[model samples]
Target: MSTTDVLVVGAGPAGLACAATVLEHSDLSVVVLDAGHGPGGQYWRQPAPASGPGALDGAELADLHHDRGTFVELVRRVEQGRAEGRLEIRSEQHVWSVVPDGERYAAHTVDRSGGPGREAGSTTRARAVLVATGAYDRALPFPGWDLPGVMTVGGLQALLKAGGVRAGQRVAIGGTGPFLLPVAAGLARRGSTIVGVYEANRPGGWLREGRAVVRNPAKLGEGAGYAATMLRHRVPVRTGRMIVSAHGTDRVEAVTVARLDRAGHPVPGSEQRVAVDAVGVGWGFTPQLDLAVTLGVDLTTDLAGTPVVGVDDLQRTSRPRVYAAGEVCGVGGAALAVAEGRLAAAGIVADLSAHGMPGASVARDRREVARLRAFADAILRAHPVPAGWADRLEDDTILCRCEEVRCATVRSAIDELGATDARQVKQLTRTGMGWCQGRVCGYAAALLSSGRPGPAVERLISAPVPLGALAAQPTSEPHVE
Candidate 1:
């Protein structure tokens, strides 16, 4: 068994910042566990060491616009911290369960390798737990989305950033938020033929956002950079437009685009069929709260109406000694995440100390967090998921890809099965029972099932746990720390 002062459940920007700050502020042993092989999570992801930054024309969006450094140097800071023996990092470990032990917590994880790879994952005990599990691309079912060439915005960017592979010869980036801009720029840099960037929200919507551009010149400059890249590549950015459907025999061959009304419904006779080899679609982001939700952390919603972990000023959750940062708190940008991480670390010190640290630069961190959150709130207000989008889904459209459950099937569960809730639909139609464990279809499945959008269902085990691991454990429940 391994032990530490804190067990951080992710290695993203927020997690890394928390670890670094804790190391600097206190004399505590820290263990950072991640499913990834390296640091940087998804936002600051780096190419494999063998590839060494790959062919990316520029650094990540964070370093490009805000940090102002090469990606290599940014990753080097954390790599160097690990080398100095300040913290322990166990990569490729997918945490599935965390149980409260006497005055500490015990976390169990699998190797993330499929098949019977459970091999009794090693246990780590810590006095405090910090969950910064990050977020995932929000996916809504549409006709032909199950086709081979349709991908998420983050998935396409990962392909380019981590493997240096252009997702397709020509691709259309369709989404409702600013993230689509960077994804399009990355694709253009990788030599993909520029087609069209379809945005469901219009510029008039952004005009209502206050100070996100004026307060942050770096953000404005970044937007300008992406605009210049699009101009150079001769790519047209279509506003107030959305991809209603994808068409192909084997893979994505073309996308059917349409201009939406102010209410986000497709305008009649305004549809156009655009030719493209692949389509990258994203509505926005969903916080990955499987681990925290299972642990009973309090839940709240963000400005975008997606659920997030509610945290105190110091990032403390309702559960004692369990802190949450980054997108798990809300889907803010990386800069906000880094600030919250550092603030959460300070909270840890004050709570753990015999005397609460006072006049200790707490007010400054709070102000910064507030400023960043305001900017983030503006971004969310500017781009929102179109209303009645679920109505556009074809009856035959598969909402649950893992189980192949269709929209009609979900409605059938409600009508025929007399199901009034998501859990009933899951039992009736297997909407969220596949290998993904409902990460992909949890929100959609619940919404279609109950006519209300909600958070992912809680499970003691976030990932698959082995029977042997279960058999060896004691029958008595461990004391809550």
Candidate 2:
């Protein structure tokens, strides 16, 4: 078992920030683990060895922006700390399970590449654990979404950022939120023909958050910069629009885009087909609450329509010795994540001041957290997922691609089999048993099951069933009733 004063999961902005913050203490040893090859979790991308430092194509910049200052700083600090024998950074380590061990916690990881069949990796035990696993992309199913060239925006971005590859010869980037802009601009800059950008929200929504934007002048500048880049590339920005359907025989060839009515319903006569080789789509984002929820952290619904770990002023959750920061707590931008990471580190420091390294002044940390949280709330409200999105899903469309479950199966489970919840529907049809475990399809499944239109982020982010929760079940039990 490997032990440390703080075990920060994920090497992304939040994890790196937390690790950097904890590294400031000489007495407190810190260990940062990430499933990726290096630092810069989801946001940062390193150029290929053959390519120069700045040789990254346009899509690469889209990811590096999120790596920001604190993220880069964490990488530098970890390297320096390793030389000084104070910190350890473990890369390519995927944590599969985490369990509480008395007063401490044990993180069970797996060596995805290094191990034999189902081999167990080393364990990391720490008095305090900070989860910054970040989030996975949410894929809402539509007709032809399962085509070969159809991919989530994050998947394309990750391909470009991590592997230095492009999505396709021509790509249509459609989604909501600020993420789409950077992706479209990046691909366009890389000489990929970005045919269109279909966003579900109107420009007025950004103006509605004008007050919040003013609070963060740098964020405003970032938005302006992205807009300027997009305008320069002549990428069509279709606000109040959505890709109703993706059309292709074996690969994505075109998409049917439609204008949304004032209530966000699709207008009948506004459908238009746009030719594109690949389609990158997403709704927005949801917090990754698996690790936290597994630790028994309480959850709260965020304005962005995702379930997030409930954290107090200092980013401390209900569980002792556990703290959540960044997108896991809520889908705040990079700046807010940096602030929260430092604030959590301070809280941890204060708790261990006499026993270890001294923490920063409490007053300063509190003020910083409050200001960032307020800004986060404004951004969240501005980017709430559109209502009635499920109405856009076709009856025959594949909802859960991993399980090969269609909207018809989900509807039958709820309407015919009386599935009152997502779990029951999953049990009946194996809807959520895919590789993602329903991270991408949980919202659509819940909406299909409930027959109502509201945010399903809270339900999606709940803890996965513990072995104990399933241990009492009979081996030959019947399907959900």
Candidate 3:
């Protein structure tokens, strides 16, 4: 197995920033592992490589991304580090587990570079580990949500940003949060006929968070740009409305939109049917903490009741030699993620080297993180998941699509089977025992049984691994740095 001084577990904004910082500030050798085919993670997803036909170049893809200058600079710095032989980035490498190996850690990975049937397993040992696994879309269940052509807003944006492919000719977007605006604007720019943008929360809620808005003027400018795009495309945004059901024989053809009352319930006789070929919905995001959980790092909940890795001002976790940044710490935006990543690298440099990070620099980054995170908290408070979302689910609504578990089954598990939490419900009704291993349905299951999101169930294996790859793993001890 190979060894390095620092191993970063993502290649997104946070991971790229961390690796670049470590190389610039200290003599530490850094290695980055990511599951994506290239860098930028989900926020700055890139197009296919230029080697392929019809591939979009950097100039062509820049319009699809926000803060392109920052991404470009980070990528250039990372490339320079790679050229200098101080950093190595292994793309398409899925790090499934990280276990303690003496004073260091061993990260097991399944390489998907060769695609199907050629998967290989490998291990890397490092003295320090940083996890920047990022977050995934938070989806809520509605009637016909499982139907084809219905997906999360993030998935829709991924298609447009990664390949410039519009998902459908006519689309209906629904959710709570400002995220809906950008997705709708992007799709509309790509020639999709946006039927309507349904937002469950009113924009006036932002008036209450005046201090946060003043602290982050760039956010207001960004919001205004998206508003201009929507106005240019004539995309109608309806406030205090939600899509309660999608209807179709085979795929999504139409959606039933309902006005929400103050209690977040559907207003009687206020439903309208909107025709659309596709529907995109999102509540918010859930921090991806699988790797952090496996590392046994201290955990805490965020404003949305989602579990996040606990970290100090310098981004050091409770576990020694382990650090966490970006969405794994909390669901802040990319700017906050970059700041946290640089801070984590600074912490690593101070711990590994004789001279520590400059007091002024560290304090500056800490203040930046606090400002951006405050804006994030304001966003969460403004666009919270509707209190009565589960009240809209029908008895036949599927909770876990992989296991075919329905709403009625979950209720039965809670009422008749003495299941008080998501864990017990998983055991009694098999709600979270499907192929996804609770990634998709865990939130809904937890909220159904308990009033809040529950702790994630840790697994030895984070992702599905080929049996042959597992069989081929080396039994020898990893070389410690």
Best by lDDT: 3
Q: What residue pairs clash in candidate 3, if any at all?
A: none
* TM-score for predicted model 3 compared with the true structure: 0.97
- Model 1 error, position 287 (Å): 0.9
Candidate 3 has an lDDT of 0.90
Off by over 4 Å in 3: 50-52, 477-481
Better of 1 and 3 by TM-score: 3
Model 2 agreement with the true structure over 10-57: per-residue lDDT tens digits: 877777777777777536788888777667766675433336655554
Q: What's the TM-score of each model vs. the native?
A: 0.90, 0.87, 0.97
Pick by TM-score: which candidate is best?
3
Cα lDDT of model 1 by residue, 63-91, tens digit: 32335353344346556666877678877
lDDT of 3 at 26: 87
Cα lDDT, all candidates: 0.79, 0.73, 0.90
Whole-model lDDT, model 1:
0.79
lDDT (tens digit, per residue) of candidate 3 on 149-194 = 9999999999888888888999999989888998999899889999
Residue 245, model 3: lDDT of 93
Backbone clashes counted, model 2: 1
Compute the lDDT of residue 472 as modeled in candidate 1.
52
